[model samples]
Target chain A: MSDLEEYKTVIGLSFGNQNSSISFTKDGKTECLANEEGDRQIPAIFSYQGSEEYHGVQAYGQLVRNSHNTILNFRDMLGKSSEDVTDKKHKRSAKPISVNGQPGFSVTVVDPETGAETTSKKTVYEFTVRHLNRLFESARDFLGKKLDGCVIAVPSDFSEKQIEMLSKASKEAGVPAMQFVKESAAQILALMYSDSALVDKFVVVADFGATRSEVSVASIKSGIITILSNEQDLHLGGEQLTEVLVNFFAKEFEKKHKINPLTNRRAIAKLHAQCEITKRILSNNTTASAAIDSLVDGIDFHSNINRLRFELAGSSIFNKMSDLVVKAVKKAGLETVDINEVILAGGASHSPKLTSLMWSVFPEQTVIRSSASSATPLAVNPAELAAVGAGVQASLIAEFDADEIAGSLTPDVVNAPHLTKPIGINEGDNFVVVFDIETALPAQKSIECVAPAEGGAYIPIYEGERSIKVTTVEADADESDFSEEEEPEEIRERVVTPGTLLATVNIADVAPKAKVEVILHLDAEGKLTVTARPKDGKGSNVRGSN
Target chain B: MSAGKSIPLFPSKTAIEASFVPHAKVSKPVVRSVEPIGPYFLAHARRLKYGRTFSEDER
Candidate 1:
């Protein structure tokens, strides 16, 4: 039998810090496989009630009643020593403990047969193994096959040790991890495969996750994807936004009931859970309400918040997210106008306010993909993009031999040196780039330019650096007398500063209104060559290399 | 065990045996054979062919 036919049951696994999902390609369509609870996005929590273990939504329910036994947010603690765990205060769930120099949790478990409860110290690696085993079992039961392998989606910032730990855990769970794909690259793959017209575009992936917000700038040329820059803020995420609502409602409850819900662990946990639902409702509606029965001191707390108020309360975080996107684009040495699309990933990207705020960051031509946007032919569920893309990737490589797969997927094969700054020509005051930054070595580009209508064309090629220029425009004077003190608007424009001149190709005596062909070639050894010749073939062709 | 004393969660013998079970009977074990590569390299290495159409039962 062929490898392709033998590997038909491979799946894609997106193992996130807050949630995880499994997807598989069946009948040429990649879709998420729901767990037994019918939830495609499964909570990454494990709870032990006595001798029985619960996962996903059932485990998530243990947060309120059995917080001491439920283990959540342990994914980030993997591969870290006890001293490496910076945030030791886990108020809502079980606190982390040190077990043999590694991060572990002490949970009380009851023996079903003997009816005796004992504290068990489980390492973070064990939880990862059990969670992955559950996901694998779900796929196995659904597909009715033993299994082939899987491609796992990982965040861009995951350290090598963390990845190694995850790989070991997966192996222990009896799941063969064929490859690990970056969440950003997986998101772009999902888009490109769905729409053939998405090639050769610059994309900004703004992933507003639960515990962190990550922004990656990727340039897709033909079928190759290059990540230009990545910026992440661990402090900004959905949890922070939920905290705002929690504080808002807590303040309201304190004003009426003369008690602070934040002081009580159970009350804070319940409020945090309900506020998350309220935040989701506010994403789709103008107003939403949060109600917690017996929240604290036998009092039911209820309050309503409109979308405008929610946006106002979280405007700082929203603006910071927008600024992170801009910073990522600037770090890529490109302007917002250069971005062809903005892909919203992660569960928190479902907010309409974030989508609208992103619209203000880029030009009107940029397509923002989110659940809030109007349905288009290429629209995909932002939350499921990474998993679906990983599924597609698994299907693509399932047929290759193990040796071929290992040989191709390596850093040495694709880590070729690339151009750091743009190499282009200065036309009057404007700089026209011929070869953009992040262009892999051994690349060549030919452009046609019109020579100045007189003497020889003195074309000087330069390496350019990008910077933002802020200009203030005065408010119009035709307004009413009451608005005389209106402040002038500041406009930020992307400007390129030409750096060291690489080479100059002097084509003397070009015909008037004639077109000149200029070719730029960059070799793998960082050598640059510029060749220019008149289109009419009646001028001195000059060539220079550096 | 005492309240604060740390003990191994599971037997080390069982853990070692569990890691050696062959999941893929048809293919060689790839988990321990290769090092993990960056996402960009993996994406570039698996670039799709131009004009390749995905059809049902293509595999």
Candidate 2:
């Protein structure tokens, strides 16, 4: 491979209700491709096809026409326990949540022959990972070469655990190394790219998508974005907008054709789809038509939906997400004006009224759409920016992984994946001694703690402030950083006490194994007297008092 | 009290716990590692982190 070819390539990924994308960088240009459009966002859509199965856009369309075999909005509902959302059954005809194939999420699926049941069972992570791996493989194919590595973009709100699942899924997708990017951070990046001042700037991004509404304000500096406040409603988004419009049209049907819209499952689905489309239209246009097909009462309604009314039905929800945007700004202790920019992104951000509301709320700031064009991209595409950022992160991380193998001066520290508590500490978990409610922790001050051993045992220098988190500390004598103040006048006959640490074994073997012997060094002040033998070979650690 | 009444300035417990060992007449105050200065973790995070990520050449 050429030098440029040797530069590790990483594929950036982003996924949504019905689509997933991949982007790759080569020769200073990046390429994007949407792998799953006609395909089901999650192929687990037909996992339990008792007799036959329906899938892809066909299954999506079948949702409205054939109620017996269709599920929608099942993606976002994953990972949530049933107790968290019992009403999910009403929203999705078949809840697709599953637990070990227990139908955690259900979707009604009509048997191609029987047309009896339209539901299957599986955990959200399991099902979603399966589909995600499939989608990722398709994205991998876009390169037309063997896979290199994958960078997966996860929702900003994904829990640490979710990221773990993402890691596993990425591995299953045949990508060993994966990096994470917050969706909001990615949007903020695209928002920043549209303008460079994004570094050291504060901006609120209201990501209103088909199934989720997330509001986050981030501060960018030195190409790093600090997510300040993140609040989102996984259960809320464009779906609610569609629901309100569905109800409005249902009422109109009752008045114009004397037919209730909800009596027929097929009609409800078709109407929901129609309302969703019209809602998007009304986001910009003053009005749009909502078309519904009815059978039993021989009724059909094509009603004009005004932008004003659309906002009336779902403005609260939008404003709810907006309220959080305000909080995002507030969390940074900045007013709307303090926000240099506001990013209108996500599939739902296209709402001009929503954009207008965001603008009016922060009249001074530019209410720019993070992603603006259809083909050429008027702005950065917020939807896929996380993927791009993840790719960038992946590339950087790939370099780190390679460099790691090459060896660096980084202090050898213990870190285990899924080890919540690293022997003594946890992953990414650090406690600082700060004076304020939530401010930067000051430089760690050395403090003394005792284990209260039976006999007089010598004290070993402990590194972590939190008892659960211990770090390896270099001996002060070995470090050049410490300089001696004039030696304290030694007290005559002070005498070494029996409790003195005769020897310290610093390095130890893993649990369930023998511990490595520790070498000891002592100082007059009774500082930690510890050292370690080189594990590889015999370079006997020197032991004596300094 | 005699003119040369001997008095211990510090309790042996403090000295011993300070990592001092007993010596004959006029025991020298030998210092060990830095007590207060450290990259200290309470229980020891490094032992765990290093134990897994990097295998000892012995392995």
Candidate 3:
């Protein structure tokens, strides 16, 4: 291989549903990059006030008044149709519209001079592109140079289509050379690099963010981390806790001023912001009081909530989180005793109540021959851990490029593939497993099957744990982009099917009972390659066909 | 203080016992892996991306 040149500037980005963070590697140390305001984590929000676009923290502030124009929670809507929206908050916050006949959001824009209002339809993909553009722009401003590449960390549950869309958006956003990684896997990389002694351990990662909670069981053996099982709750998140407080404060304000804060979007947004602060304050203190002046219709609102009251109000959300942890451990085919340590990620994990809940659920000791009693949450900065880990990955990727770029820094982390679903071949209506769930990637498996004389062998390969209702739609070529008004791409929903079809392989003109070897290899980037060959046939070997 | 400090999300002392009862059955794990770049997902992204190409700016 020829010597590859190093980049002038690159960054690692943790893209979350609610907030995102950026980090970079300098002199072998991963440092979280702050925005212009010197805040490490920036709100994943955008606001448009008559063509004046604001992003990050500024957009979050504008959301208080321009609730209709500000866009948040676009991350959760990726690869999902309007019908797929189950959360009431998302449904209420984002006005669903048709984009080219597909599900999209409507942004209400007002004319600056005429005071006329108009609406524009945009898909989640377009929204993501806008966000990515702003993120790259921020990084460029911070570094005083354009970014050459980036490694963005994403949720483990993002679908293949979603990942592809993100990659496409990165290219459109001017960051063409980019890589995507699972957030938990990135966190594990950061952990491994920080603690060299970490090996042969079964770690459960509980990543509780603003709008979702993810629990994953990962085992590290021989310098590689394999995700045993992953479970997530879309409904259970810090937003639920914030909603509890939002409602609580709203009701209190209503009782005093005879005005329902929830009735007004601006008031709700302001209360939501205050609730977030109260949630953080209640984390450390026994009681936290929230006071917002001119919160709703020029009325000041004050509400005091003790930890006990706050916990009771948000108990359902916590219950859902605990439920997810149990399911994750069960799916991993392990008991609580098997867990070495629970690694926490995201800002919500810092809540004392939530951390205590984690300890109670996964105690160090339970049954006979218990290895550990109470497996405490790993001590790490939960907010920036994933971003920092992504920086480490970018460094590792850089090292693989050239020895000059490595410059005396060698990350002791081995990138592992944590399969969300089993990759298998469909044979006679029965799924035959090739790569089992949680098997570390850069792994391969071979299967031998007899070829039929008449029809040969038709093998359908799929990647998914359970049967999913998939609707494949092609972009309508007849539709023109220059149309005055766009409809959510005229998508005709077809027959619902099960499983994602990775590829199909056909073995033709083979004698009956002829041995055919089928090998499937999952690469480091989670891409699969299939090779098929017949034992007695020459020039019939299919190499890396998929 | 620690014993009672924990919220009674589940009524029992052993929180896992009651909390383990899943309120909503998860048909699929929402946490999806990022699209593994066919090149990098194979453990060769950097080798394939930078190993061969020298950008004009870098040179």
Winning candidate number (DockQ): 2
lDDT at position A309, candidate 3? 90
Ten contiguous residues with the weakest lDDT in model 2 chain A: A418-427
Best by lDDT: 1
Q: Is the docking of candidate 1 incorrect, acceptable, medium or high quality?
A: incorrect
> Between candidates 2 and 3, which one is better according to DockQ?
2
List per-model TM-scores for chain B. Answer: 0.19, 0.17, 0.17
lDDT of every predicted structure (CA atoms): 0.74, 0.48, 0.65
Model 2, B1-59: lDDT tens digits are 00111111111133231232222221123211111101121112232335421123114
lDDT of 1 by residue, A16-60 (tens): 778888899888788889888898988889888879788998998
True contacts kept of each: 0.01, 0.02, 0.01
TM of each candidate vs. truth: 0.77, 0.60, 0.63
Candidate 2 structure quality by residue, lDDT tens digits, A34-140: 45463312223433344544544545555555554454444444555545545443454564443553335554446766667644464556556666666566666
| Model 1's TM-score against the true structure | 0.77
Position A432, candidate 1: lDDT: 70
| DockQ order of candidates, top first | 2, 3, 1
Candidate 3 per-residue lDDT over residues A1-546, each given as its tens digit: 444434546788888878888888888888788887877888877778875777888887886677767777778667766677544546336565557655567787778788887888888788888888877887788878767778888888888777887888888998853567889888777666767422335678788888889988876532356677899887678888888999888887778778888987777877888888999888778899998888877888887999899889888887788788788988987667556667777788766766667667765342111111134334446878888888877766653444433321222123344555666666334555555445554445556755544425455567645432334444455664565555444322211122667776555544555666766665545666667677677325655433
